[model samples]
Target: MAVTLRPEIAALPPYRQGRAADAAAFKLSSNENPRPTHPAILAAIAESHLNRYPEGAATALRTRLAERAGVSIDEVHVGAGSSSILYQLVQAAAGPGDEVVYAWRSFEAYPLMVTVAGATSVQVPNLPGGHHDLDAMAAAITDRTRVVVVCTPNNPTSTSVTAAQFSAFMAKVPATVLVILDEAYYEFDVDPQRVDGLTEIANYPNLVVLRTFSKAFGLAGLRVGWVVGASYILDAARSAAIPLAVTEPAQRSALTALDIETELLAGVDELIERRARVFAGLTAAGWTVPEPHGNFVWFAAGDQTSAVAEVLEEDGIIGRVFAGEGIRISIGEEGSVDPLLGSAARVVQTLPKAGENARLG
Candidate 1:
C-alpha cells in the first residue's frame, strides 16, 4: 500500500519557514521587517486595478528596478520572490547527477530546492567562526557541480563572506558554473568589507545576484523579488518561472515601495541601530550571541540551545531554534527590543551558567 513518490523529494526534508505563534506572541522568528509597509506602498497596492492581467514580462517593474539597480531593463528579471526565483533557477539549471554546492548552515533553501530539481546537494561546511569557508566550498566544486549559492551575511549565523574571499572562490570556479549571490538581507548589513554582488557582476558573467522586497522592503506578503544576471541567464530564469506569476498588486506594491525607499531605508537604519543594541545587550548578558550583520542576532548556547528554545516558547517569544547551537532573534522596533531582551534574560536568568544541548527536531 505504498505510494511511489519521486526519490529526490522523498529523501529530502521539508523546508521549515519561520512563523509567528498567536497574536499574543512577538513574531521575531521570521527575519522580516517588524514595521508595516510604507504608506505609499500600501496606497499603490490598494489602488491597483486588478481586472486585467499583470504585465506578462513585468516590464514596468523591471524598468523601475533597472533604474534603481543601475542596470538596464534587460539586466533585471523580476520574479515572485527570491524563493520563487531560486526554485526556478534550480528547475532551469539543475538535474539528476548534477551538483549544487553551498555552505551547510547557509540558507536552508539551497539543499531543499536543489534536491527538488533532482540534483545532488553538496554541503560545504562553515568555517571556524561560522562563516562560509570559501576556499573549501570552491574546492568542493567538481565537474558535476553546476551551480553555487552564496548567502552573504548568512542566515541564522549572520556571518558574511567578504568580496575578496569570494572573488578568489569565483576565480577557482569554472567560468561555466553559475554563482547565485543571495542578498535577501543586504540593506541592514553594514559591514564595510561585505561583498556587494552588484560590484562583482561586471567581473563574472556567470554571476547572478538575487534581491527581494520581503526583508528590507516589507513586502513579504506581496511576494516581490528579482535577479540580476547576464541577459541570457536572466531570460532563462524568467522562462522557467510560472507564467503570469507576478500579479498587478505585486508590481505596483514593489514600485510603491521604491517610491518611499528613502523612508524605508530610515527604518532599516533604525533596525541597524537596534541590531547593534541587541548584539551588545546579549553580549553583556553573558550570552554568546554572534555579531550578525543582518536584522537578527544568533544565540549559540552550545548544549543549552534546546532549553532556551523551550523557555522562549513558554514565554511566547518564538525564535528559530537550530540544531543544538544557534537560535535566531530578529531585530524589530526600538520599543520591541526590551521585551525580546527580557524574554532572553528570563531564560538566561535561570540557567546555571552552562550551555544547553537543544535542537529543532
Candidate 2:
C-alpha cells in the first residue's frame, strides 16, 4: 500500500517555473535582468572555498545589508531567495486552522506557499486595473489571519501598491498579524509614490521587508535574498529555514554585487526605459495593458491567453502565460522589442476581442 500522505499536500500541484526559450526565441517568460553578470561577481564566486560549509548565518552579507538599511545585524535574515524567506515566514507564522491573507493574482506562489504550510489562503481580488485593492484586503483579515503579504508591482500583473494606500491598510491591521512586504522588483519601479518598504519597516513592529539579488543584481543563478525586520520575528523565520541553504558562492557574489550597486542599478534603469517602450508599443497595438510599474507588462487576454501566447511564440517571443487569464511579458533584450510588438499587434488584429480579451475599461 502507498504510504499515507496529507490529503491537502497530495492534491497540491508542483510550482511551475517560467518556460525555457529556444536559441531563436527571446525568453521573457521569467522576469529576469537581461544583462550579463558583472566581472566583480564572477571573481568573488571564484574565491569561495567549496570544501568548507557556508557561514551558516551568512553573517558578512547580513552585516552589510544591516548597515545599508540602518538596522542591526540581528534584524537582517538571509535566505536562498526572497521566495525562500517568504516560505519560511509563512511556515513560522501560520499553520492548520490559521489563515494567510493576500491579494489575488499578485504572486503566483502565494496560495501554494500558504497551503504547503498547512494554512488556508484568503485571497482578495485585484482592482479593475490589476492594482491591489488594499481596502478590500484589510477587510478580509480576521482573528484566524496570522500573516498578510503585500507584493508591490505584483507578479503577473506588474501593478504596485501606493504608499498612501499601504499606510491606510496598515492602520486597519491588528498589531499581532505579521505583514510581509515582498519587494522583489523594487529597483525597476519608478513610481515616486510607491510604498518604500525599508522606509516604512521601522514604523511597524509586525512588518518584514523582503529584497532579492536575483532581479536587479543579475544574480538569479546565485539565488541570494534577505529580509529586514524585528529581530524576534526574523529569528522565527530563521528557525524555519533550511540549514546551509545560502551557499558560500551566493553570499560572496551578493556582497560583490552590493560593492558595485551603482553600476548594477544602471542596468536596472535601462530595463525601466525598455519597459516604458514596451508599454507604449502594446497600447499602440490596440491592447489596453495595465500601466506597468515593474520590469514586466500584463496582457489581459482572458480566455484567449493561450492563442495570444501562441502568436507571441510564432514571432520569437516567449512570455509567462496564465491560461484562461492573462499573459505577462517581461522586458527583455533590446533586439526583442520589435518582435514583441509585432506579435502583440498581430494578436490584436487576428483574435476575437471579447470579455477580458478586449481593452480593459
- In candidate 1, position 211 carries an lDDT of 94
Tens-place lDDT per residue, model 1, 1-361, is: 9999997688778988887678767777888888876778778888888898898798988998787778888999888889999998877888999999999787777888888888999998887556888888899999998899999888878887787888788889999898999999988778888899988888899899999999888998889989888888887788788999989999998888877788888988988988888877766656665567888887766677777777877777788877656678788666667777776777767864433321111
TM-score to true structure, per model: 0.94, 0.98
lDDT of 2 by residue, 234-340 (tens): 99999999999999999999999999999999999999998899899888888888889888999888888888888889999999988888988999999999999
Kindly report which residue stretches of model 1 are placed more than 4 angstroms away from their true locations once superposed: 1-3, 353-361
Clashes of 2: 0
Candidate lDDT values, in order: 0.82, 0.92
Q: Lowest lDDT 10-mer window, candidate 2?
A: 352-361
State the local distance difference test value for candidate 2. 0.92
Task: Compute the lDDT of residue 163 as modeled in candidate 2.
Answer: 91
